[model samples]
Target: MSDHLTVVDHPLVQHKLTLMRRCETSTSEFRQLLREISLLLAYEVTRDLPLTSRQIETPMCAMDAPVLEGKKLALVSILRAGNGLLDGILELIPSARVGFVGLYRDEETLEPVQYYNKLPSQIGDRACIVVDPMLATGNSSAAAIDLVKQAGGRDIRFLCLLAAPEGVARMREAHPDVPIVTASLDDRLNEKGYIVPGLGDAGDRMFGTK
Candidate 1:
């Protein structure tokens, strides 16, 4: 894929995303909606995955069938919030390898500090999708990607439910080679570094936390 952003505008994805954005949506419903939407987003992210033909036996005869080429794709969740998206994508790409990069923002500096990281052995040879629900400031996301690269991830794409203009710009500058895919690109980040008009604290909303 080109080095650009892809906003998934499918009707179902938009409708489900709307539900997720509502303040009154319950944790159970919000989680369900995120799962539903992530499936559609996965479809778009993997749209151009390379395919190879293999001989298969049909009921009537043997024929060549298309199958995914190379090693199974890798799914790396960017901790807490990313787990929501990860669960859904796993349902669709069940055979994919899994990894996690945990980061928490330092309140004083508003910068990301890595606390945990575990990646697949063959990450460099496989396509890796890093998932997070919100791309608010992009610091943590970029840091997570850097960790993935350090662990040998080369072909990487970022997936998020919502993104702010500031966050998109940050990603563009820091990692232009990594394509970004999201459901919506909101206006901008607020004073506290949250996405404006965004669903409040995706991790808190999805997990019923304060």
Candidate 2:
């Protein structure tokens, strides 16, 4: 509905996200909530996917029904935190191709560096969805999308569990053509780069680490 990022306000998504935000939530519970919320978010993300008419046999007579049109989906998880969202999305779209982009922050430059990359062949022809839990600074996320585009991924979408306004603004400026889907858009980023009123580090929480 809005430009740039689409916030999914579904009651279930909000309810589960609340559990995820609580300080007492266990690692197991947090992981479960991430999967559930990501699945719910996936439904909204794929809402406008193109469809084509297909001939099908009903209980009695033959009928023409609508089926998804175009190439299979290419899911690129911005590794570590992004993997949390990937598992649930795959459950919903089992046949979707998978890709991974490993990036780490350059402490000095505050930039993103690619450490790993593995994507399906002909990424340009497929519809690509990049997943990440939090969009804090937007440097890594933007860099990941840039790599995807360079690999020929023209139709791209970004999915996240939480987003900060600063990060959203950065993404809009960097990649306006790629729409963003997230559960909530938070107030702002703190001095340390953690989102204010944010759900904390997604990778550490999901994996039960510091």
Taken over the whole model, the C-alpha lDDT of each candidate is: 0.92, 0.92
Q: What does the lDDT come to for candidate 1? A: 0.92
lDDT of 1 by residue, 96-201 (tens): 9999999988877879988889898889999999999999999999999999898888899999999998898899999999999999989998888988899999
In candidate 2, how many clashes are counted? 1
**Ten consecutive residues with minimal summed lDDT in candidate 2?**
104-113
Cα lDDT tens digits for candidate 2, 1-210:
576789999999999999999999999999999999999999988988899999999999999999888889999999889999999999999999999999987766667899999988888988899999999899999999999998889989999999999889899999999999999999998877888799898999999988
Q: Candidate 2: lDDT of 178?
A: 91
